[model samples]
Target: MQNNISHKQSNQAPLYLTNFISFPYQSSQQDIPVTQFMALSPFSVKWSSNGTGYKLYANSNPNPIYTGTGTSFDIPQGFKHNTTLMLEASNAAGKLYAFLTIIISKPTLTPDSITVAGTMDNPSILTVQGTLYAKSTLTINGTLNLGNNNSFNDITVGATSNIRGKATLAQLTANAIAGGASITTDANCALTLQPNATVNKLDTTSVTASGSSNIADLTVNGNITANKASITMMGSWNLIKQGSAFGEMTITAGTDGLVLVYIDPDNCDAGTNATAVITYNGQQYSVNGVNLYQVQSNNALKQGYCCVPVQKGTSWQCSGSTSGNGQSPTIYVYWIPFGADKSS
Candidate 1:
């Protein structure tokens, strides 16, 4: 008896693959058959009496990689790198096929000195055991630290940047453009500012401005020892020109009978014939062995005259005919003219 199977009576429409995704990611040895991986065709056949079979053909190959009688078949190895495989399933009623791209390269690391640039999402982390370098700007939103004795070259911290740890560098350029930005050193460490650098404010134990500097305010917490200069208060003295005497005159009785007057050289011209009257009990006396009363007091009141009738560190004492203990007289002070020319 001869049996006939018609396509109209067949249950198979097309090969219904369980997973159409590419097979195993890695390939076995080059051009070698790798039978570990398998593909599945999960469809039912109407003519199961004839028994179903499967075949996998890789990349234009006419021969079947594996022919068997099941819904699944082992993936063939010996496939070239990145080749595609066509899986065919057939029975007495009908036959269908599905295409799957195969991957054949084992995972490998980055080649030496090759740079790869890509974005990392989902909060990924990259850990480097060796040195990492960024030729351009390196902006870290979080903290950055350097272990002890580690040094960085030519680092520039921005205006908003805050350096907390102790950073020791061969050379550093820090520009604090923002307000309230400052460089603070550790309590134990000493902060050294090089020559010609100007700082608005400084709070340290000791600061040595080797070069000229203008500081708004400097608060030193320790002793300030000046090696070469002295700190002086700010002020001066002016020459007060009141009046002048003209000739050999006896000091009359007035307010401050003996007035300690400032003989201004600007007003009292040279060669003026004037002498100081030094009389004790109506007897003429001399000062420092120089007869001032005879020397003509005009020359006595010149500039650089040590004994120009001025008291040292004390107010001038006046003893006139009307002066007495506890009852002093008020003698008027007047500029008597002894020279031909007189000044106010």
Candidate 2:
């Protein structure tokens, strides 16, 4: 009897185990918060008592926390945001005990959600797919799982988020990628990875400026910046500026002034124009219009991008107000082929 009781003691309250996450995400889509995590997925839980083995609440209702024989447990979904993570531990003599309540939460996700914190002794992994708009700070251990085509929309990480193994897109931007990560939505597709003044990761992708178009305010890292007077972008509509501080726009032309078209990576073109949305970037003299001879198209736009220059009259409204961006921008004088895709 004592031996059986001893065995139970070894399997107490919050079990300590490895962890994993599964969310409904993809490489070229938007990211939605996941909601369920099966108990089988391993989790490291500190025991309530100084020793091992205990009871865990599997359901939110009936609230029947179970007493297990081992230190391992299978937690359920819905119960994730409990916040009050409590556990019960026991000893060989059938002594039940409680321990410190730990906080278990991660960035909000879709199908599966779990918080993985990287500690000095126990650093964990954070797998982000598609376009990630981190409203908070994230930490990673050896590596952060960044799939190709994955974009981080305005999220900051620990000093430097790296993968001792093979990290994916530690530094990310853009949307409409080929594939790899499991993201589903294109929210904040114009994602930006804060330039860690100290740690600047290389961007594997390239943004080319051609035709009579040029780019301005698009900073540099180690990434390639293709420039020319002609923009070889994809469609009749092109170039989605930094929606917020969306970098800057340079209009290239053979002559002096012309109209410019700005696409919305967040929304598709609305019939003749794209829908307009406003972010936090300033908008006084920062109007989305053609600056009289911003730059010349035939010239190289390492600092600008342009299209087939047109007469000043072709000035069409893509989706902004002659006043404020009351709407989205259209590829007025240029073809709509340019946009920021999340490339790894």
Candidate 3:
């Protein structure tokens, strides 16, 4: 008896085989981590193939390091560096080839530049040999030790924040405070508070206020000295109680027989003239002229009080005079001192 024999043969080569990689595939772009990639003694690998047999070659090896009739294979690991691998497969139809680079160690780097696009939580300390710049706000919740000088355009400190370290700056600028704030410095510390600033206890070298300054109370522990310190006042005093017009009104001499007006020597402005005028009845009278009789009893000294005696209901009044019949008229006063250094 004769039997008919038949055999099947492949006429087309393998096509579209991809993702030829080992398990836990380590990408070329990322550092090959230690426990997952480098520690495997024999890293397992698998590939897609429509071929009969395959052979894997390592770094310039003339002989195949691994051979398999199936699609999966193993790479005898124990590699200490980046390794190059080549995969060759062949079948009755044709042959196919692929290449791979395995990473067995992390790359060494000086890391001159690194941009952290996402949050980086590193438990270890990072040393930056070059400058580290942040396009936005760089918040540091941990301690940062700066190896070199750094410059910042603006910095805001919270009300609870405090600067306690010693620093010597060539130039330092601080903004004004709108609300109440306090600044305290040591005895040797030198602090300067510029315009529009407020503090509770200021032991500073200098405090200048070109703008408005409101201090509830200021207590200076050191010596208080003034240079060209001055207080100026300009206005007139209204002496009369009732009047039919708006000119100088004078008060009739009272029965006290005492000088009705006296200027405190310390509060007087010496060099300038403080001319007196009397608005009496309905007309204006100058003290240097008609109202001079009020001080005639004391010879009308340029300073001090003058007495004038007259009966009530008389129209003898001094217009814009500080003294009245029995009342002291309201007047504005200012103090300004001029000279060398004066201490208090």
Q: Best-fitting candidate, measured by lDDT? A: 3
Where in model 3 is the C-alpha error above 4 Å?
1-171, 178-181, 229-344
lDDT per residue for candidate 2 within 23-71, as digits (tens), equals 3223122132233333233233322234345565432433645566555
**Residue-by-residue lDDT tens digits, candidate 1, 17-38:** 3333332334333233232232
lDDT (C-alpha, whole model) for all candidates: 0.39, 0.33, 0.45
TM-score of each: 0.26, 0.17, 0.24
Counting only residues 3 or more apart in sequence or on different chains, how many pairs clash (N, Cα, C under 3 Å) in candidate 3? 12
Greater lDDT among 2 and 3 belongs to 3
Query: Where's the lowest-lDDT run of ten residues in candidate 2?
Result: 1-10
Ranking by lDDT: 3, 1, 2
Candidate 2 residues lying further than 4 Å off, grouped into runs, are 1-122, 127-131, 135-142, 153-344
- The order by descending TM-score is 1, 3, 2
Model 1 / residue 271 / CA error / Å: 17
